[model samples]
Target: MELLRSLTIGQYVPRASPVHRLDPRTKVLATTALLVVVFLARDFAGLGLFALFLGACLLLAQIPLGFVLRGLRPIWFLLVLTLLLQVFFGGTSEGTVLWRLGPFAATREGLVQGLFVTARLVLLVVATSLLTFTTSPVELADGMERLLAPFRRVGVPAHELAMMMTIALRFIPTLVEETEKIMKAQMARGADLDTGGLVRRARALVPILVPLFVSAFRRADELALAMEARCYRGGEGRTRMKQLRYRRSDALAAAVVLAASFAVLLPGRFRW
Candidate 1:
């Protein structure tokens, strides 16, 4: 299915760029900070500032804009639906009426609200996709484990949690590929997956899901056995092939991110 091709969240692109060279922990924390700014933003100016920073990060990563945006193709319908809802049924009813359709009338306030919400959603996706595109799953896991290690004083199992999260992220592309293969195999067997009503199409997908689930479980079992064979214990006493260390670049990057964050927050906070 063409749907699988648009997914870029789990796929990594290797490049000799500043973003890729930074410490993984720094990137992870920066991503978290940007997401916080995205959620805290209340107006277009704040969101626009965040968008500008995200665009710069995209450029530094050496990833194609087209490839990063391809992840949005699958969610176009969702974005449209969200926009339409906010335009038609916003929080307040008092504003200049733009258009009317039966019981629902689009208002100026509703339009602004719709655009703001949609922008946030778009920025959120691009920010996260940038992280995965730059950092491999292994690096992500290592960073997360180290970041969470301080919480190990409690009953938390940082290593296991990171391992699980990494494995799940790593399996996304594999499962997508498996789903495509199953879909094609069914298509060749005279399966009519297309050209059907809504209900009929829902029924058509059932065959694909069953086989896909079975395949996922089979793969999981094999992986578990393989790990056991290698005596893969938890992260305790395990050393990395390449230990992560924060370099001078990481500090400069952090300083830039901090300044950019304050710049974004202040623009909409107090008149500048």
Candidate 2:
């Protein structure tokens, strides 16, 4: 529960750093480019460089390393499962085996593949966290709406999609807090959530989940009513108070991101 509360995935951190001051469009584009580079990377050398770049970004953002990394704790199980699956099932029988457990074997090639894949997943999460950490929910929605505006020509509901995404992101922390409260209330009533097998513990969550779902629905209804009370409508004619504009800093940031992306691509292309 504490870990869930500590998650920085959808939460925004306010700071005076350059990254925070960057235009939301610039950050969105840079993050997308970085994700593309991460997927294109072919070897550990390229990944190492990308890691360094991401570390520098975090520093520039003035975000604490611990805060950014704590988000990984909730996903550690998935990461480990991915690595283990790759290590045991990724390589061919001809490859050198590093270890054996019954019929399953971990090969050197498999280890490399596992580490590379896991690194990609970790970097992807961290890169996205950087975007949410620096950009406010309103800015994120505006930027996403702008980025997707081109798709509107194809009859896509870009503004509505962006609004939905913004609401989801805004409510993630709220839901987590609500879940924590529900769990505590249950615990105070002698609900035994611990000291049980996986299935048993999952069953124990039924009581907590019931009220959680009820509360979530109630909150959603309240939110809808509140918006209606304010005479809210779709984004057809909506305008933002703080319009997004690209300044010199945004241009410089874009250039730097592009250059870094090119650097990451070069190694994979030329085998440097």
Candidate 3:
């Protein structure tokens, strides 16, 4: 339950701030651009610049820093494992060896590489989290549909895809809660989930997974029925009560992200 609650990626927080007020399309485009630049970044300077940028966004959104950081908790194990793996297994043999842990030699280059890769991943998650934090799932769907509409000429189901993505994000918390309940129920029935070898642990998951799948399918069917009852059709004739438009601020937001990406990424290419 604690692990599931730590997932903040799909959660939304309402705020009356510039970041939240911007057109969702602008936010979507800017986030995509930021992610691209983050992946293209070569060194710490670029990541630092992005970290600062995201921090500023967090402040503008008036979201608690603790809430954003909480998302990192669930992934702590993965991060530590990645750090350990890179420390002992990554980097070339010609690099400087820092020390040895058992039979594994930790290299200076590997440590540096591990830290860099980890920071990159942190930035990526924070960026996406910021987007979902400021923009509601409905707005995200509309923005995605609009952005993907151009591809409709080539037979893309923009509305359908956007709707699916939005529904998935909105249901994350619900599914997580259901999973927790199922686990607890099984635990009460004397199911040994924690104390087990690797294979035993894998086998234990079967009970949890079976019920979860059934619950998920049941929910999906109910949702489908509900939508059908409402005569749901998001096609050519569909109209929205709230229309999305691009304003000067939207243009400025995109320009700012592009400018920052160049400012950081271009200079980032020439590194130590």
Candidate 4:
């Protein structure tokens, strides 16, 4: 649980901007469309446009740039690794040679491929960050439940899945704070967590994990009891305290996303 807390990405800063006011479903669909656009993009120009689109969305969402980049920090190493691998191990076909080293030749095709792939991944992550930052977990889960209502009849427990997701998202920040507190408490007691070798450090985590697990189970037990005491059940005719409704803003946002999708797909001098 402690390990999981530091990795959570569900913390949203609430705002009253147009993006924040838009329905969660609209933001979700727009992000999904942008993801598809990133993957379908074939050249640098298309990738640039996709990045611009994401930037505009982020600006509209009013999420802090520092916060978004901070969230991306944990995966920066992986992104670098992937880019390096692509640059060297990519390109199964011949193209203009850019560099010739001992046993490897870097070609234009490989360079373009690697750069485009990295840009695509960056755009995807940024777009998703925008979605999560703009939409609160409860709103997201509620929107998702309503969006997935049609699947409820095909043996799909849509409401249950959404409720589970809501709980998990809602608890991420709380758990992260708890983990930090526990680590600090242990450190104050002279626990040497930072100066140990790999194996030794792994063994040292036992104390942290045990308490984390105990606290997590205790919280879950209390939550279950509270739910039962309130006569809570599954989504069987359950009414929401704040029901989600799609307004003109949602339609406008959807229209903008569809237009952007078409713009990305349209053919012209930039066509690849």
Among these predictions, the greatest lDDT belongs to 2
lDDT of 3 at 186: 93
Better of 1 and 3 by TM-score: 1
* True-vs-predicted CA distance for residue 91, candidate 1, Å: 4.8
**What tens digits encode model 1's per-residue C-alpha lDDT throughout 52-114?**
888899898888899988888878898999999999887477788998999899998998999
- For lDDT, candidate 2 versus 3, the one ahead is 2
User: Tens digits of per-residue lDDT for model 4 on 1-272?
Assistant: 34544452556878888999988878877888888877776666666776677778778777767777777777888888777666666876467777778788777767767877777777778878788888899989988898899998898898999999999997777777877888888888888787779998998787778888999999999999999999988999988798778899889889988887767666423554
TM-score, one value per model: 0.95, 0.96, 0.90, 0.90
Please give the TM-score that candidate 3 achieves against the real structure.
0.90
- Each candidate: how many clashes? 0, 0, 0, 0
- TM-score quality measure for candidate 1: 0.95
Q: Judged by lDDT against the true structure, how good is candidate 4? A: 0.79
lDDT of 1 at 115: 90
Off by over 4 Å in 1: none
The positional error of residue 243 in candidate 1, measured at the CA in angstroms, is 1.0
Task: Give candidate 1's root-mean-square deviation (CA, Å).
Answer: 1.5
* Candidate-wise lDDT, in order: 0.89, 0.91, 0.89, 0.79
Instruction: Judge candidate 4 at residue 241 and give its lDDT.
Output: 92
Clashing pairs in 4: none
Residues 1-272 of candidate 2: C-alpha lDDT, one tens digit per residue? 47567776768999999999998999999999999999999888888899999999999999999998888887999999999999999888888999899999999988989999999999999999999999999899889899899999999899999989888888888889998999999989999998789999999999999999999899899999998999889887888898889999999999999999888889689964
